[model samples]
Target: MAEPAPHGTPRRYRHGPCHCDLCRAAHAAAARQRRRDKAYGRYRPDVDAEPVRRHVRKLREAGLPLPQIAALADLNRSTVSTLLHGRPPQGVPPTRKMRAVNADKLLAIRAEQWIGAAS
Candidate 1:
């Protein structure tokens, strides 16, 4: 037999200020919209994957522990362990090197322009 909810048992509040019936419905709808947006990459940050992988490799080469590497890289410790052990980190997509050659070229151009202006 199912036990009835205790008297005056408070209902769990959703994640918003207003808790009226309409407000609750609106909040639920908004939460679903946010989830959809995240799924479609509308609300996600662009994470560069290669840099994270490189950093993980470097940390492993430097003899850093998994916990230490995770703390320094802002990654989960389990992710660090997986990377070190030659396994893929869960839910982390590989990132491309966005500014690899372009960054160097831009820096060189800026340095030349700075020298010309200074001279």
Candidate 2:
């Protein structure tokens, strides 16, 4: 069985099934932080995948394999693959967005650095 969540926290109010004043305050505080971050442009959680997808394609065309691109981007091989070719059958569709951090990682890779290394 799972352990009980501690008090005086938003998690307690959410997962701990707590509705005490402390828990409510904690949840409200967390919400405020989120709002502030969004307002200040510091809460970029995701970004458009089109640019990253194009970069991945360019890297592949420049001789970097999927695994190499994944490693250079510090991402999973499947993630890189999914960026290029999404899940099929039911037509789940390619990724429309990706985590901002991940997009940064992928965007940092340059095809020039791996053009000859792929050999």
List runs of model 1 lying over 4 Å from the truth.
Answer: 1-42, 46-48, 84-119
Best of the candidates, TM-score = 2
Worst 10 residues of 1 by lDDT: 2-11
Cα lDDT, all candidates: 0.45, 0.82
All candidates: TM-score: 0.32, 0.62
Ten residues in a row with the worst lDDT in model 2? Answer: 1-10
Count clashing pairs, candidate 1: 1
Compose the digit string of candidate 1's lDDT tens values, residues 19-83.
66666666677668668988987754334445555655654555555565455445455444543
| Model 2 residue pairs with clashes | none
